[model samples]
Target: MPHPPPLGDSAGQPGRSNRVLGRRGCHLPILPQQDGPAAPLPASPGDAKLQRAKEALRLAGHPGDPQSLEAVGLMLDKLAKENQDIRLMQAELRVILILPFLSLAPQAQKEELETLLRKSEENARLTEALQRETASLQAAQTELRLLREKLQGLGEAGLQRHRRVCPAGGAGTGPQGQVPAHYEGLAAALSTFFGSNGTFAHDRLSFVDFLDEVEDALEELAELLGVSKEDVDNFEEMALTQLEAAPWGR
Candidate 1:
């Protein structure tokens, strides 16, 4: 095998010394080519004109018989037309492949949109239900408060009745100018009960339970005042009769 020839050497050119510096700073020898078949030179990458010519020849894809300007121009034109046809075919094929997915796109979008709408409707319904429940709870709380106030008013009225009958330093007394110790005790008990346990007292008693306690207190008052059961019944009947007789009450 023959060693490669030096740079700038060709078949026609005579040998000449190219004094290149080696890695060790010595002058390297560039020998001339011995007679035989000359090796094909490697194309330089930086030679843009050469590369373009070679690429044109490759695309031309035919022997350069009777190589002329006209012949070369005709080959390159044919190659350019063929490349254009290939690119058009590729573009058409891309459109063909993508068409099916494009056709189904609307249905997919519709399903997604319907799902979102359904979710939105469900959220609205839940929100409405929550609002209704909140309003109902508030109304119930208000009604309960009014009932408690009414009960408290009734208790205050009972206390006032006891005070009027007793008067504080025994000013006016029932029948005789005398006050019963039991009657005084009952008044004291009423005061103690109302004073300690305020309106909405501890234990959170229900309206019915609180009314039962009021009834018990009234019974104690009647007993201590020495009022007969018949008198209490007559008084209750008379009160009811008066309410029924009134036009507003009826």
Candidate 2:
């Protein structure tokens, strides 16, 4: 994309120095007040001669061919609507500016004021609906946020439950029923050999039965002494080969 010419580069440009920024503001014509139902007066967006002068240098851009007519029609409709809006405003303002001078009874004026207020409220129906929709969306978002938090809490609780369920079995309580650190550590290490995820490659069934015996012997050893099984890098050290020669039994 090409960059716009710099302000300094346009120093010698004829129109650049003369160009005025912002609007000159609108002028409301002073006309004799005519009493009647409010109706917009004939209005134009700008001077036709000025518009034509500007258009001479650069004619209006348009959609090419077939769709151009439809586009033009839509644009004309928008312009017409905007022009009608000006007339409506003029009529309303004329009525409002003359209201104070109208020689009407206070009761009549009060009734008219009430009527206008009622009309204004009626026109605000769409705004009311928008407000209701916004409130409902906020309620739904709040409910969604609460459900997400609840789901997160449930996930954390499930994780805690999973942690409590020992893969190698027996979870004890406090004091005398507390699990020995060595027993916990050894059981955690041996867990893979007891389940479907076990890495045991041979005599798995016999190995599982042997593990049950080991558990019993290990429990007794924990009750008698503070020590537990160690040096378990090889299967031989844990008596994995012998049917009954277990480390805990020793």
Candidate 3:
């Protein structure tokens, strides 16, 4: 390597000079004119490392352009330099730790490292894909819930229309109006079980809790409708089976 330029002119100039190469051979911007001593280097390990790399590159006749191999050499050189800096020691330690493994099978080292790199890249790609899938699943669940609400609203509207056309408590009707006796009984039971406010009034329930609520509510409804416990249990089982058969449920 060529000898670095002298820190200053041998004869010395009229004004004092303060210059240091930044990382990647970049000429650090000139500091502001100071009345006194120059500011100290960054105290942070990361910042100090970056500064050292740049200074090393400048000494090697390379501008601090990190993209260049010369700049990379400066950084690698820092890690190899004899220093008590904790950060540098850790970097060297990592290299030292891996040396035994690399030397054990020099011929296969390249292949093994390449395989490890490929697997790491694949793991990153899979992690990103999984995140996107999770977002899509959440969106789908929201849409499904909204659709269920709309369907319930429409069903209620249809029942209202039926009541308007058919007089309440008519010869063939239940006391609760044109709505069937069983449906009315079930509705009352649902209101009691679900806080009597409305369906899904509370948003804090977990999925398991919601399922349990549905089961208990159904039992209460069956009792009100004079339906057998066995029948309700069988219906619940069938509903779960259908759910498992659906792609989303799975």
Candidate 4:
């Protein structure tokens, strides 16, 4: 058997360079750049070797079968495929504490991978739920702001009506000082109905400052009359005044 080629004949290049395999000096065999890195083939340990392979039938060579070259190429292709699968798998996975996965049992590895998957799914669900809750809170805040603005508007409107209805004076007056005929008649009739009590006297000129002043005055008058609770019209004047002057809660 022939010995392996010399490390160098006269050059500084790392591996043998010769015309037999082109100036791509260190590479085993020149093929295409697509397979992977063009590397030197591994040496066979002993009896198994390289130089003694069968050559392609049409070419001039030796002791192996016709399928040898094609078989070696297919093996390299399988190796390249395995390298690609490793790259793809690593993209989605990460090892904790930089530990090598191969050191753990196969079942332990499976459990670790499943735990990662379930945690990732739960994190996604929680993120989506938090976003929805945040949106609902923002909507409720907007509605509350609008309601507060509406309530403020109503309060301002009521205040404006009060100022218009009750101006800065002890009495109320509508337009000119003279009363209309029917309105004067109504006042005179009310005066005749109440008759000379003087407190309830309604005339062409008299007016109340507060809206509830007349009703309050009437209640005072009824209390002074010693009127029965159910029949206000029937009363003893002396008994009513004495009761009104008595200390309350006695």
Candidate 5:
């Protein structure tokens, strides 16, 4: 019969027995922590180093610094040509910084920038249009003001001339060889009702209407002058026939 196995051993025999115990099975070993002080982390990469170098140059305030006095003398000799290089470099750096911001900026900020540009363009257009409109309105106002001033300067004799030249209402006379105050008031009212241009076109139609309204006034004037309404009507008919013969009447 086989002997019993020892504790922590499986049939303690020799090398062949250790193989039977499975000590050489696929098991991973635990690595030890590094000994002594740790090595410092590697320096920043080339790009970062370059950036730092540029920053240091800027801080040093020696942008025009050269590799040697000979290089400096050469740059000084071609200073005007070298000056444009500094401006070009600045422009290139601005573009580099601006490009990343443009790419990474929020969508809303981009839209707002577009909206601001559009609004500025629209505002400029509107401002120009308003300036033109204002000039036109000012010119029109000036013309109207001048016309009103001319009208205000007219005397009674001037008004009589106006009535004779542009008559809508009849030029009936009152007592003592004077134009009736009512006739002047009526003519002014008619002139105001129909503007300067409209007055001539609407004269006959407006006069017929005015005659009907001031019939009583006309009758009173006729009685004062000892003339009959029939006589006045006959005179009006004859005048109408003559006016209807004109080209405007067509």
Candidate 6:
């Protein structure tokens, strides 16, 4: 009834107050601690550092671990198989592409190609030989033409001289006429020269052989005529020219 003598008045009241405080004290809630048999977290900071050190050591020219070696071998084997497959595909493609050409090329075509090559080589050789022969023939022809022209010129000059020295007179002219005597003698000698005993005595002498004999005889006649060699040469050339101009000779 006195209000309990004022609550905080005595020293012995401290124990009673402590007990009240304990009853109303604040405390932290206790979490359940994860223990063994539970799934662990990822490696901690210190464990990660140790793992990195081990990786660095392994990378510094160290032998790979068994797992890494096995994985690498498997990768290399896969690459090798892939390479082989690619090579096989390439070979197959080549075969497919080339087979048609090979089949389409006839045996005869191959032979003809070889033959053409041989013929081309032969033709080259023959062409060189022909060129040499043609050049030689050309030179010979040039020399022959020059000789013919020289002979022709000399014959013309001789004929002119003979006409001056031995002028033929009229029909009644005597044997003393220089032209008449020379022609008569030449005709007689030619007839005798062409007789059976002559060099051109064959029944059917070639025109060339006949002419050669005639030219020889004319040479002798020119010497006997006491005329220049040019005169004889000119007379022979005139006879040959007349023969060549004859229709029968042509």
The candidate that achieves the highest TM-score relative to the unseen native structure: 4
Give the alpha carbon lDDT tens digit for every residue of 132-160 in model 2: 99999999999999999987886666445
- Candidate 6 is scored at a TM of 0.30
TM-score of each: 0.28, 0.25, 0.31, 0.31, 0.30, 0.30
Judged by whole-model lDDT over C-alpha atoms, candidate 6 comes out at: 0.63
| Cα lDDT, all candidates | 0.60, 0.55, 0.61, 0.49, 0.56, 0.63
What candidate 5 gets wrong by more than 4 Å, as runs, is 1-97, 154-250
Please give, for residues 1-250, the per-residue lDDT of candidate 4 as tens digits. 8874655534655654433434554435434346777677877653242333232333333336546556666656765997899987786466543466555659877789889999999999999999999999999999999999987886666555434433434243333321222233334544542335434334543444321443354345444433233322222222223223212412
Off by over 4 Å in 6: 1-110, 170-250
Clashes of each: 0, 2, 7, 1, 0, 0
| Runs in model 3 lying further than 4 Å from the true structure | 1-85, 89-105, 168-250
Flag clash pairs in model 1. Answer: none
Per-residue CA lDDT of model 5 for 159-188, tens digit only, reads 455345334453553222234334455455
lDDT of each residue in 117-199, candidate 3, tens digit only: 99999999999999999999999999999999987886666556444544466665432324333444444544433443333
Candidate 1: list runs displaced more than 4 Å: 1-103, 106-111, 171-250
Return the top candidate by lDDT.
6
Ranking 3 against 6 by TM-score, winner: 3
Residue-level lDDT of model 6, residues 214-243, one tens digit each, is: 778778877654557665665665554433
Please identify which of the two predictions, 1 or 3, would achieve the higher TM-score against the true structure. Answer: 3
Candidate 5 residue pairs in backbone clash: none
Question: Which candidate model has the greater lDDT, 2 or 6?
Answer: 6
lDDT of 2 at 137: 100
State the local distance difference test value for candidate 3. 0.61
